[model samples]
Target: MRIYPIETGNFKLDGGAMFGVVPKVIWQRTNPADVNNLIDIAARCLLLEDGNRLILIDSGLGNKQSDKFFGYYYRWGDHTLDGSLAKLGFHRDDITDVFMTHLHFDHCGGSIQWNKDRTGYEPAFKNAAFWTNENHWQWATHPNAREKASFLKENLLPMQESGQLRFIQRGDTSFLEKSELGFDILFVDGHSEKQMIPHIRYKGKTLVFMADLIPTVGHIPLPYVMGYDTRPLLTLAEKELFLNTAVQNEFYLLFEHDAHNELCTLQHTAKGVRLKNTHNFDEIFS
Candidate 1:
């Protein structure tokens, strides 16, 4: 199976929100903030060419949102989801499955688009089956007050309305050994309800799509939880277990929100699990 990194776009977010209670004096060492106190973020998605099934994980924020709405995020960069796909000699119509880690605007917003005449919304990947766990589907559709802003209806309903929405039947456990997409999934709840972290076995290595569980190398320290997480305490425990397991298993973590670092591996450190090495996708895969 061949896998490709699809860079959707780049944007800046408040460093304080990204690092939660972690002091700026500390997080700044790893993720330095700009003069505006915002740090760079990338919507890096993953594409897998496994046989005939061209699967994409985490579509980045699409361009359908109004300028006013996008101004809040302070977008930057020339990369785009469409351009990235074209670079790989593929297109949105070529995607057979779209595996969403969660329904946050920045993560799944690219799944829908404004139809002709802008009268209504439609599935961005018309031929692709939008995949998400049933539990998360419900949670996202009926979002709570704290998360309501992140779960936009324009980013969701269209998938279901297009009758292309599919759910991975999960057992009563935090980890699913195999999903319908032929990859393992680690369910995390601290960030959001039932956030699915994909563990793809490829090229004799396990490349894990870190998603919101461990967004960046800066977030590896466990206590550096994002303020956006609903259950910070649960996040601490989940991160501890996942980080330890990642080090023991020697998994390669692919970051979705980290603008600079592409991938990293962890090791048991004096201060618990810490980054062992950083690698460019082609550098290690080559």
Candidate 2:
């Protein structure tokens, strides 16, 4: 099995919101913010190539939103979903499975795109089966007031309309029974309802796609939770347990929104679990 880091694009978000309760004085030291208090963020996705299946985890924010809608998050850089796929010798239609960690626009927007004449929406990955858990699917479709803005109908709806949407049961180990993507889904609810983090066993290493559980290495501290999380207390508890397990087993955490740091390892420190080392994705694999 081979895994490629698909860097879809970069965007800026309010640093304060990204690092909830944590003071700017603290988080700014790591993820330094500009005068506008906006910090760089990457819409990083992962691609898995195994046998006849090509699975993509999290399709970055597609270029379908209106300019007014995109004015908020300053989407920059030359990277794109199609360009990144081509870098790995593939295309959008080459994808067989799109494993969404959650249905947030940044994570699943690329799942749907404008049709030829730009009249209606269509599945970006024409032949792929979009995988998201039943709980998350419902939360995104019937979003609450706080998260409604992040869940856009244009980024969704089309998957079901195209008859390519598939829902997995939370905590079900059998989700991968029929797939070639040798991975298991780890469910966490603090960020959103049942966000499925993929625990992939590759080349004798356990690499976990750290969805929003620990978005970046700066989020290693249990208290550095995102303000967007519905249940911050639950996030603290879940993160503590997740990091402890990650440190003990030496798992490589793959960041989704971190602008600079990509993969990192944790160690048991006096201040609890802290980042032990950071490396690029190719370092371990190459």
The residue-level lDDT of candidate 1 at 178 comes to: 43
- Residues 147-185 of candidate 1 have per-residue lDDT tens digits of 999999989999988999988877533222243334788
Summed over model 1, clashes come to 0
Clashes of each: 0, 0
Q: For candidate 2, write residues 1-286 as lDDT tens digits.
A: 6899899999999999999999999999889999999999999999988878888999999989999988999988899999999877898889999999999999999899999999999998899999998878889999999999999998889998899999888657675566545588788899999988899988888999997888888889989999999999999999999999998899999999998999999999899999999999999876
Per lDDT, the best of the predicted structures is: 1
What lDDT score goes with residue 284 in model 2?
89
Candidate 2: give the clashing pairs.
Answer: none
Candidate maximizing TM-score: 2
Assess the local accuracy of residue 169 in candidate 1 as a C-alpha lDDT between 0 and 100.
70
